[model samples]
Target: MMTLYGRRGWGSVLIEAQLAYYDLPFRFEEVDDLFTSASARKALARINPLAQVPTLLLDDGRVLTESAAITLHLADLTGRDDLVPGADAPERAAFLRWLVFLVTNLYPTFTYADEPTRFVADATAAKAFRARVDDYAQSLWRMVEHAAAAPWFLGERRSALDLYIGVMTRWRPRRPWFLAEAPKLHAIAQAIDAEPAFAGTLARNFAE
Candidate 1:
């Protein structure tokens, strides 16, 4: 069994999706908003110097951080490596490309959109920063729409990239401007949410 330390955020949702996909038995330790609290900070530092949630503690006492790394590690452990492309296969290169693309391009845009003030000191500048993020997010989703082969990011099988993209797509509708710009992504999100494991998790989390 694994113990997952997570908050109710995108990273946490990705961890949950991976657990469900792998049918891995695990305990969820809620990190909550106490990430800044002294105790939470101390405990996280002891496990991961980054003091990040979505940290996984393996049964053997090893700790894993970074959602992508954790998901890939769990896939390997459960012999579900087919969810990820094999290293020698052509799809493997594409898989790595999209995985990094989601992390570097899409994820950062969401982070900036969620917390605009972090990037700018002035209130006016922060609003402008948010606007820029909104634009970037739309462009990013359009890129995803072009790259996605339909049914899944990597075609039939659900990859870690799909889980990441699904979470982000679900989040877009909450933003008024981005929601209107993301029709294709919205469809992808619906498809992901319709999956039994994902729907079950959403129902449990949001009472849907």
Candidate 2:
């Protein structure tokens, strides 16, 4: 069994959704109230020196950091390589491209919205940073809306890209401008949220 160190947000929800989708048995350790806890900080540092949640400790003691990496690793373990596109398939390149795009381009947008100060300590500079992030996020999401294949990132079968996109899309309500500009992404998020696995994960971690 694997041990998952997670908190109550998207990082945790994403891992939970992947695990549930694969029916993989794992122990969940919640690191709640993360913003003010030394213990949480220390535990995360010990497991993933970067002090990040959604770290996966495999039974053999290997630690995996980054949510997408952990999810892809698990998919490989469960022989669900198709979920990420088979290694030899041409679509594999496309899969990798979008996966990296999600992590590097789309993911950071939410971070900027959540904590603008991290990018710039000065209020003036922070506002500028937020504006750039907002514009960049919108541009990327428009591309996503236009490039999306049918109902999923890769045609009909949902891939890890879909999962990542789904979580990021759910963050749009906070940015209002996102959905207003990227209606296709909004529709995609709605469809992904309605999936049983995604719904179950949300119910377990975010139910009101």
**TM-score of each model, in listed order:** 0.84, 0.87
Candidate 1: residue 70 Cα off by (Å): 1.5
Q: Clashes in each model (backbone N, CA, C under 3 Å)?
A: 0, 0
User: Which residue ranges in model 1 land beyond 4 Å of their true spot?
Assistant: 34-42, 173-180
Summing lDDT over every window of 10 consecutive residues in candidate 1, give the lowest-scoring window. 170-179
lDDT of 1 by residue, 27-127 (tens): 98877464236788677678888777678899899989877687668777887665677667667887888887887787777666676776687999899
Candidate that would win on TM-score: 2
TM-score of 2: 0.87
For model 2, the stretches where C-alpha displacement exceeds 4 angstroms are 172-178
Error of 2 at 147 (Å): 1.6
Clashing residue pairs for model 1: none
Q: Mind giving the per-residue lDDT tens digits that candidate 2 earns over 113-175?
A: 556886689999888888888777778888877777867777776787877767776564443
lDDT of 2: 0.75
